[model samples]
Target: MKIFKKNLVKMTMKMVGSLALFLGAMVIVPTSLVGSHQPKCPDELLK
Candidate 1:
């Protein structure tokens, strides 16, 4: 019983860590690409 509980805790931690990493990448990649490749608008367009 103790071993099973330990294994379950380890698995849960691993799952949570991977989920957080995946979500971070999903958000960071698009924002980083947009920051690097955004196009400038003409001054007239802003007026």
Candidate 2:
């Protein structure tokens, strides 16, 4: 019973870590892409 409980806790932590990574990437990736792009402002405006 102790072994089973330890294994279950380990598995749950692994799953939660994976889910946090997935969610972090989902938020970070799109924001990074948007930040990297130049806006469509005219060259004259940039000068």
Candidate 3:
């Protein structure tokens, strides 16, 4: 029983770590692409 619990904990941790990495990449890739473009705001909207 103890061994099974340990394995379960390890598996959960691995899954959580992978999920975090995927989410981080999802956020970072878009920001990096937008940053590279540096879109300018339109002059009409400045009013």
Candidate 4:
């Protein structure tokens, strides 16, 4: 019973960690891509 509980806890931790990682990548990837595609400011604007 103790071994089973330990395995369950390990599995739950792994699942939660993977889920957080997946969500973070999902959000960051699109924003990064969009930022990369955005047009630069005009030269006149820098003056």
Candidate 5:
């Protein structure tokens, strides 16, 4: 019973950590997109 409780707690923590990381990435991605410059490229560069 004790082992089961410990395992449950570890799993819960892992899940919460993953959720936090995903949320952080979600917020950061759009922020970088908004701050980026327009496609600065010539016709040759497009190839």
Candidate 6:
């Protein structure tokens, strides 16, 4: 059982956690700054 444990497993878990945090910020912070710069469509919608 002891042999099953490894340092690489711990490091991999930490890396996955950090990557999740970075991805969360990417979706959240940008939306606040973007505000109302969205594009609008009209003529195409009528067809």
Please tell me which predicted candidate would have the highest TM-score against the true structure.
Answer: 3
TM-scores of all predicted structures: 0.74, 0.75, 0.77, 0.75, 0.69, 0.54
Q: What residue runs in model 1 are displaced by over 4 Å at the alpha carbon?
A: 38-47
Candidate 1 lDDT tens digits, 1-47: 99999999999999999999999999999999889986889999999
Give the per-residue Cα lDDT of candidate 4 at 13. Answer: 100
lDDT of each: 0.97, 0.97, 0.97, 0.97, 0.94, 0.84
Clashes of 6: 0
lDDT of 3 by residue, 1-47 (tens): 99999999999999999999999999999999988996789999998
Local error of candidate 6 at 2, Å?
4.9
Would you give me the overall lDDT of model 3? 0.97
Candidate 4 local lDDT, 1-47, one digit each (tens): 99999999999999999999999999999999988886789999999
Supply candidate 5's per-residue lDDT for 17.
100
Give the lDDT of residue 46 in candidate 1: 100
Q: Score candidate 4 by lDDT.
A: 0.97
Kindly list the per-residue Cα lDDT of model 6 for residues 1-47, writing each as its tens digit. Answer: 55456677887899999999999999889987897676777888978
Model 4, runs deviating above 4 Å = none
Q: How well is each residue in 1-47 modelled by candidate 2, as lDDT tens digits?
A: 99999999999999999999999999999999999998789889888
Query: TM-score for model 5?
Result: 0.69
- Candidate 5, residues 1-47, lDDT tens digits: the string is 99999999999999999999999999999999987867677989779
Instruction: Extract clashing residue pairs from model 2.
Output: none
* Residue 30 lDDT in candidate 5: 97
Per-residue lDDT, model 4, residue 23, is: 100
Model 5 misplaced regions, further than 4 Å: 37-47
